[model samples]
Target: MLDFLNDILWGKVLIALLITIGIGFTVASRFVQFRYFGRMFRILGASQAFKHDKHGHLSSFQALLLSVAGRVGGGNIAGVAVAITLGGPGAIFWMWVVGMMGMATSFLECTLAQTYKQAEPDGTYRGGPAHYISRGLGARWNWLAGLYSVLLLVTFGFCFTALQSYAVATSVGDAFGVPVLYSGIALAVIVGMIIFGGVKRIAKVTEVLVPVMAVGYLLVAFVVLGMNLERIPDVITLIVKSAFGLEPMVGGGIGAAILMGVKRGLFSNEAGLGSAPNVAAVAYVPHPANQGIVQAFSVFIDTLVICSATAFIILLSSVYEPGSGVSVEGVALTQSALADHVGDWGRSFVSIALLLFGFSTVLYNYYLGENSLNFFSTDNTRLLNGFRVLIIALVCWGATTDLSTVFGFADVTMGLLALVNLIALLFLFKPGLRIMRDFDRQIAEGIEQPVFDVSRFDDMNLDAAAWEIEPEDLARIRQREAAAVAQGK
Candidate 1:
């Protein structure tokens, strides 16, 4: 039943929806993802406008790292291996296509998240598909928001945590002969320590870990690519030719290539699935589009860089056997590829890397659910605390148990979440476009720093408190209002 549902939802319905939305968003936004490609770094380098509230809110860079932490996970390693194994080298080409298109979808969804975010009593911001569905679409659509929140909680909070834990346990067990039970317990404890400290601690930890893990992994990939320099051209040609079914080695045909590419690509980067926006909304940026651009860049980094690294490593190595039905499982395939290239130490290196990737992903999944819980009932501390305990338990269980069924269920829920979010995004498309236009206009007028004016969005259902100006800026604005009042009198 789980496989049937997954086949129907992810294989048929969600794949088309993902591609259509990606293309639609890309066209609608006038390719804002491409236009602001370089500006992403500029916005990321800018100092936080609300540094005083750093404990409660995240800087743009921190939020980018948070989203990246969620994205560059076990999926980048194991998931890529699965795509290549099932769909051949052509799958990598399709993955790149989806990544390119998904960047625009990411930009739109994240901009909407920022525009509709709410300010919490603790000075934190919370928003996502649910927040936008209720707030942007008005009270009548609150049910849709509730549905989205429930699906998000189930998908990320429970299922994905398990999936990530399973990857870590399996990889570590394979490499070190560690018992799954022991690894599961240790995994639970380490996750509990960071999660208990709340989003601030998660942010601090990921901000440091994301750069280190991503760069180190890429460096190793570069070395592998460098060693196989002679095969680079052949590998590139194979990927393109396989993608189009021009290569005889690809038995799955173009349809399978597209399906696996879209499925795993979406899983890896999470561009249009409404997951990243939860974290994206936590950033303190000058303009809502600032975070949007930063997040769009994240898609590039996840697929174009990190995921591509995994693909290249596998493709360049002799361990990858095209058209072989006996290929290794995801993490094992990656381990085998690296080990074949370097040595036995390469397998251990991959195990440690998987642990780090899985750890950060589990942390991210918890926060996504916690944010959903916040949306559901802000005052229900009991429920929130209970949910955290449930999450920790799920983490341990996932580590110890086989998660084939769990992953199937997760895929179905994720599909539903994306459907709900894409519908809401379509409804609220104009506001997102308007917000982007306003930001672009500011940049066009030579504003070195573009700040969002709350008054400009008076007609929209935005939370004023969430977009309130800094103290210094507020004082200056008040003086201008006073001067205008005096002049009118």
Candidate 2:
């Protein structure tokens, strides 16, 4: 039944919806992701100025890293391997295509998240598809919001966490000869320590660890690519040819490549899957579009950069032969590719990298669950605590479970969550555009830093505590606007 559902959802429905809607969003937003690409870095650099010392609020940069932590996990390593194995080298091309389109999708959804984020009783900001659906649409949609929240809880909290844990366990077992049970137990303990500390702790840890892990993995991938520099063009040609069935390969033809590519690509970057916006809503930014732009860049980093690196490393190595009838070995394929380049130590390096990447993702996924729990009832302490324990146990169990089962369940739930979120985004399309126009208007008027004008959205019933400017901040914004106008900016 799971396989049947996956075939229907991923093979047909999601492929069409993801591509069509992603292209629609890109065109509708006037290519917001591309136009604001450079500004994303500028806004990220300026995050320090908008830092909130508020207990539950995250700085924009921190939120970016947290989202990155969620994105750059097993999917980059094992998932890429699976795509190549099942869809051939051509699958990598489709992955790139979906990733690029996903940036626009991510921007719209995240901006909506910020626009409708609620100020929680504990001074924390909360939002996602659920919040926006309920608040932006109407109380009648509360049921839809609840469905999204539950799907999020199951997908991120249990399925994804277990899948990541499984990746870590398998890699460690393959690389270091560690027992899966021991590794699982240790991972659970380590994860428990950090998750118990809550979102603030997760933010702090990811801000530091995400950069280090991503850079370290990329550096290794670069070294492997450098070793195979002469074959770079050929590899690129192979990917393009295979993607369109011009090249015969192990994963059948163009159809398989498209399926695997879109599936794994979404798994890696999760742009329109409605996960990143949960973390995006926690950020403090002068304009919601500012964070939206920043979040789009993360999709670029996850797939275009990191996932591409993994693809290159595999393609360049003799361990991965195009059209070769080799069974998919998930993370082990990636580890073997590195070993072929750098010997025994390469395996250990990949194992350690997966542990870090997967661990950080575990933290990010847990926070998504917590954020969703906030949607239901923020005061359910006992239930929240029990769920934490449950998550930890799932992580341990994931280490020893069948990879296919874990992935199948995750794919089904992820598809459902994304389907709902995309439908909701379509419904809120006009409001989303209005917000974008407001931001563009500020930018057109020569505002160096566009602050969101809450007044323009008064009828929207957005959370005042989240968007309302304080007296001093409002004064500063007006002064800046005046200065810009005087200088004819």
Candidate 3:
């Protein structure tokens, strides 16, 4: 049943839907992801992104880190290897394509997340596809929202967290001869401590770790590629040729490349999966588009930068013959390829990287689950506590057992999660575009920092607390605008 479901959902429905919706969003938004590409860096680097609000909401940068933590995980490494193994070198090219289109999909979904976000009792915010479907599309769509919440909870909150723990335990076991059981126990304990501290702690932990791990892994990749600089051209040529069926290798032709690339790319960056927007909605940005643009850049960092780094490391190695019949799958394939470049120590590096990647992802996934639980029943304290304990237990259990069947089931749920989110995005496309256009209009009018004015969107349902401007802040915005006008004249 799992295989049949996977084949039907992933092999056909999702690929077409994801591509079509992604392209539709890209076109409707006038390629906002590309048009505002440079500004994404400016938004992320601005002091506003780092500033903590009086209400204790997460800084925009912190929310970006949380989203990145979820994105830059084991998939960037082991998953890329699997793509190449099954789909050939051409898969890397298609992954880039998916990442590009996904930027627009991510932008649309996250903007809607912020626009429709609900103010929580504790002063934080909660929203995602579930909130937007119910609020943006109207209460009649509440059933669909509830369905999305359940799918997200099962796919990300529970199953994926266990899989992340398993990846970490497996890597540690391989790298240091430590038992998987021991690693699992240690991971559960550490994860419990951080999670218990709540979302703020998760944000802090990821803020420090995401940059370190991503930069560290990229540095190693650069070194490996530098050592084999002469081979760079050949690898690039191979990827392009294979992508177009010009180079027939391991996984047959263009069809395999497109399939594996889109699959693993979605898994790695999570652009349209609706998971990132859960964290994105938690941010305190002046405008919804600010967080949306920041998140689109994250998809680039995850797939184009981090995942591409892994692909290059593998393809540039002596061990990575296109038709090589060697059965070194997943992380082992990556480790073997790296070992060929930098010696036995290369294997250990991949292991440590995977461990960090997997650990951070668990934290991100746990928060998404928590957020979804809040959507169902915010007052259910006992239920929330039990859910935490359940997650820890699942992590430990997953580490000690083979969950291939369970993981396949997760794939089905994940696909369903994307399906629901993409359909909702289609329903809310015009509203999302209106928000983006408002931001662009502000920029064109010489507003240095765009601020969302809820008054303009009176026809649309929105949480005023999320977008309302204080009088003092409004005064400051006016002063800045006046100064800009005077200077321009």
Candidate 4:
């Protein structure tokens, strides 16, 4: 049954769905991502007051960490390998396009998640596709929420969880000669210790690990690119050719390449997957949109930055043959590609990084499933404990199973849940538009600096006579709007 389902899951069914949604979102947003491309990173990095609702649990920065943890997980390693293997070099180009467009979709989805977020009995908060879907589309369609929860558990809880374990074990065993079983056991124990502390702890760990892993990994890629710098121009040309249906022969021209790149890129970044929204809810802020923008930056970090690093290393190595040499699979292929040019020891560096990447993902994924389960029931202690146990057990199952099915299963689940999420966004687009305008207006009117501050919101008079925001935020928004009206940005 798993095998049969896995086939349909990864085959055209999910692929078609992903492509359609990516294209649909890009069109609906009027290609706003391109217009906002310059400001996206700049706005996210600007110093602003974060709205921290008195009831909020996590900080805006913490929410980004959680979302980053989920996105930067197993997919960054094995998912990329799978894309290259099946889609050929052209696929990388498509992935980049997807990442670019997906950024807009991510901004929309996360904005809605924040709009519908809930305070919890435990002082923390919970929200995601499930919450926003039901809230936006109306309670009549709550079943969609239930369906999305099940898919999330299967995809995030089992498939990716196990994939992470497997990646870490496989990479560790290859690099350190550690036994796979030992690695798995250690992974389980370490994961339990971290998750026991819950969302805040998970966020803390990811904040530290993500940057180190990302920067460290990028530095290595830069070194390789420097060595093969001469081929940089040719590699870029090839990427463009494959992207535009211009592939020499055995491959499809630029069009197929573009699609392939988008496919893998979306899989890697998961902008519309509705996964990041779960983490975005935990932030300590009054205006939920603060976390939305922060989470949007995560898509940029995962796909635009880290995934780009992997692509550069692989292509720059001039070692990524259509039919490869070592039959390298998963993280091993990635490590081997790095080692080929950098030296044998480079594998160890990647192996360690993969371990942090995978382990952090498991902790954050637990939060995704946990939030869903919370939505399903309130005082069911048994159910909550059962969820934790089930997630852990699935982690073990994923570690030992044949990964082909796991990958397929995850793809299917991700697509299915995202289907319901997309529908929810359609209904909620009105509120989302209103809130974004309000946010931008807040900046334009000089109401507040773009920062998180819950106390400021407690008694806020929306109808205040004078605009109270910081001068800079409002000035920038007006400037951008004026630019848009002038140059049609």
Most TM-score-accurate candidate:
3
Question: What are the Cα lDDT values of the candidates?
Answer: 0.87, 0.88, 0.88, 0.68
- Candidate 2 weakest lDDT stretch, 10 residues: 468-477
Question: 215-244, model 4: which lDDT tens digit per residue?
Answer: 887888788888887888887776666666
TM-scores of the candidates are 0.95, 0.96, 0.96, 0.84
Instruction: Kindly report which residue pairs in candidate 1 clash with one another.
Output: 90-243
- lDDT (Cα, tens digit) per residue for candidate 2, span 190-297: 889988898888989998899999999999988988888899999999999999999864577999999999999998999878999999998877789888899999
Predicted candidate 1 versus true structure: per-residue lDDT over 337-359, tens digit per residue = 99989999999999999999999
lDDT (C-alpha) at residue 37 in model 4: 57
Ranking by TM-score: 3, 2, 1, 4
Clashes of 1: 1
Q: Give the TM-score of candidate 2.
A: 0.96
What TM-score does candidate 3 get on C-alpha atoms? Answer: 0.96
Candidate 2 collision pairs: none
Cα deviation at 55, candidate 4, in Å, is 5.3
Q: Assess candidate 3 and give its lDDT.
A: 0.88
Q: What is the lDDT of candidate 4?
A: 0.68
